[model samples]
Target: MTASASQGASSISSSSIKRDASEMNNMVTMTTRLDANATVRGRRRPPLSRRQRGNLSTLLSRRSPFSNETGSLAIGEFEPSAAPSVDGVARSSLRDARILVVGAGGLGCEILKDLAMCDGIFVDIVVMDLDTIDVTNLNRQFLFRSKDVGDSKAAVAAKFINQRCPWMNVVPYHGKIQDKDASFYRQFKVVISGLDNVEARSITSENPIPTLLLPNRWLNGMINNLVEFDDDGDPLPETIIPLIDGGTEGFSGQSRLILPRITSCFECSLDAFAPSAAVPLCTIAETPRIPEHCIAYAYVLQWPREFPDRKLDADSSGDMKWVYERALERAEKFGIGGVTYMLTLGVVKNIIPAVASTNAIVSAVCVNEAMKALSFCSQSLNTYMMYMGSEGIYSHTFVYEQKQNCPVCTTTTHHMSVSSIMTLNSLLQQLCDGEFRLKAPSVTSSMKTLYMRKPVALEKVTRVNLDKPLKDLMTSGEELVVTDPVFPDTSLRLVVKFTDVDE
Candidate 1:
């Protein structure tokens, strides 16, 4: 826990824990909701009004895969009781533990309701989502009513849950996750990511979470060895919580428990995800073969030419229709079949097949993991868990290893000895496309900008450093940030120990 005088830094530092106003806003909102919903318990259990019923039909009209021709939100007929007391002693955390659920979509809605039904930890359940209620979200997103279309999903879900279980307080934040910084994230003991964005699960942060769990002495030891901080630098410690991640694609879904810094972070195996396939311009333009090729041609080439000033949003029905029509036209010329408005929408939006059953199945596990982390009711998921309902009801749990040389978590800094005559350009060449492949590398030390690759202004200023001898330009034991757009996701942290070999 002690800060090293050499650099005013501790063993674990979280530069990523930057403050955000939304965190304060969410806290304040949760307080207000808890006070307001303490008594509104399910006093009314009426069926959906006429207007809500109409919206349900519209939701079904969208060529969605929901087999149900119609839908309705069923109000619970009985009052929800409090959670059973543990060991015959009432545990009030059921009504006091604050849980933040990010995303009010399919899995999000389920997580919110399942947690509410569990009932003891009902004090402050905050929900955040940037989208409004959509007809397409109706089949799986159980908390929304047809009448709630066009309303903020977070707000609607909170209101619905509060009305159903008056003692439950579901606070809603109708905003983007990026708007909140690390300070806001620290307030909650656990965070669940309900997003379908696979990339969100694995990106590395400058301030990782594992250090939060590191004992003070171990952190001190790790930092002393991994980072070379200057005598004058002082860095503050960061707060990190357990992160539960869930993803669903059609009938398949997976959930994982991530303990930042301590376990395999999302960035450790980012290479596991296959890079998206890009259609060659020739195949898309010259001789389109498959239906997907025709769609790509219209989407990639035709859209830009026809609507130069407009951005294509798959959410907009009009926009989706336009692309489908254009793609369909191209397909006709190429004698293609099996193109429809629904398929076009799916292609453009990258919509995965998700079912209500899968959302419920996956969310239950995520909630169980949350309860374990929050209440210590049972051992939390060792690491990762997946569910596949389509083939058969099957679930698998496993622990994944962090990448050995992960740009994010690895403390292995590169050590190299070079001659005094070695120039910055020479150092760059030495790295070459070998074990540590780097090209057009930009290097910087603690006190000075050693070199910058582009943006003429930066390049001009730092270009002088490139010709200077590496030994003369850098102070002994100073670390440098070697970066390139090639990796784009992680920067190389280097501590260059120079040797003057020009004897």
Candidate 2:
């Protein structure tokens, strides 16, 4: 060291020592100490040197298990046995996987990118989304550009990923998810969704397909940590393919690993969501109180009155202005403030606040969970994880109980009794009237097609059955399989019992 530098270091060290004396005095040391009078010796004198020890042990016999000679065993030495190697879930399995992505929008686009970036892993991905590209989606839907505005989002995203990643096999299904049957989804090993629609996700999760479908993605992340064989040689094979679901809203996000029938699924927490407030028809029509009431009045009442045949398009600026004007006038009558165009748009579209950073964070967690599920690299998420990043980052994870009567988890048939004299049309109409809210339902009994909505020939043949008594077509105690366009994923197995209703 230079003379000046050494002197400067010593001065700094002395100053630091002076400042640290008080702090050091207050601290209690945990280290063990020797006696205060312990003396220091330069070096310990060995009782016997190597030459003396060798001479002393010369008379003793060789002690080693192999032989007495130090070099390469004296004569006939036995070699040690080789240790058995441990095997684990291979990345090759992931490379050969068939993955399906539902929704090619914000979260969907990110999922595709994350899955594609899996180094040295090649897999097939099917992208399914019915929606077309919009100018507004450019914010977080990174796959689309300005020129691709009106193109099918699924096609555009699939094309973008294929072009960017030349080796990726991304197939685009430019149609509504409803178009694909449960059988189609069953072809894939994993189905990851980037959808926000509760109904759509529900359908995907519960559809009795063999393919595991994720209803959400994750909000937290870490490096993949997979264990090979444990103390036991051959680990039991995993039977359940987990559904990794995650979502983000503004600064808050979450990801859950759902083992369908085994773990608490999305349906288990369905009851946690507060039911939508019901606006009484009389209040919305006669005594509108707030902006929402006025808006509902314009949507549910005035639209049909103004244009009987035309449908009010929520995406159209002109249609929205009409609703806003009517709502604004109604609000003024009720002395209600805070009714604006943006508010109208939000109310009509049911737009939720979304943040790009939150989506990225949650998407990473979801994708990572997927990797673990595919290769058993690390433990999958216990059940639920939540992330809140607004006021600094915070997260928590917990296990939620699975629902006993979850339709997705259980094979219990849902039974409903209808009047024996009721016509097939009335029976189908009854589904729409009660708690179900089912529309245009089809029915089958013992693999017999009783009614279906498609194909003009089938519709014509079934039209007569709609007019006939339901009891006449099938026995009262028969088991019927019911499927519909509304709840595409839920194929309800209903046991029909005929009875008379007072109404």
Top-lDDT candidate index: 2
List runs of model 2 lying over 4 Å from the truth: 1-93, 120-123, 163-169, 181-183, 199-241, 250-252, 264-269, 272-283, 296-323, 388-392, 415-440, 443-480, 486-490, 496-503
lDDT of 1 by residue, 300-399 (tens): 7788899999987766878778888998999999898877887776555545567888888888889877765654434567677878777798989887
lDDT at position 178, candidate 2: 54
Residues 1-503 of candidate 2 have per-residue lDDT tens digits of: 99999999999999999879866755533221223234457443435555445431221222333232232212112222122111112344456778877778787888888877765353589988878887667888899998998799999999999999987889999876655554565556555666662322111122211111222211000000011234664322232345566666678878877654556666566565433334567777787777777887787789999999998888687999999999999899889888888778766655555788887777888887676555443455677878999877788888878767544455568788888888888878886555444546888888568888888899888888888887688887789887754444456688888876332
Q: How big is the RMSD of model 1? A: 23.9
Worst 10 residues of 1 by lDDT: 71-80
Query: Where is model 1 more than 4 Å wrong at Cα?
Result: 1-90, 145-150, 197-240, 307-316, 414-443, 450-479, 482-492, 495-503
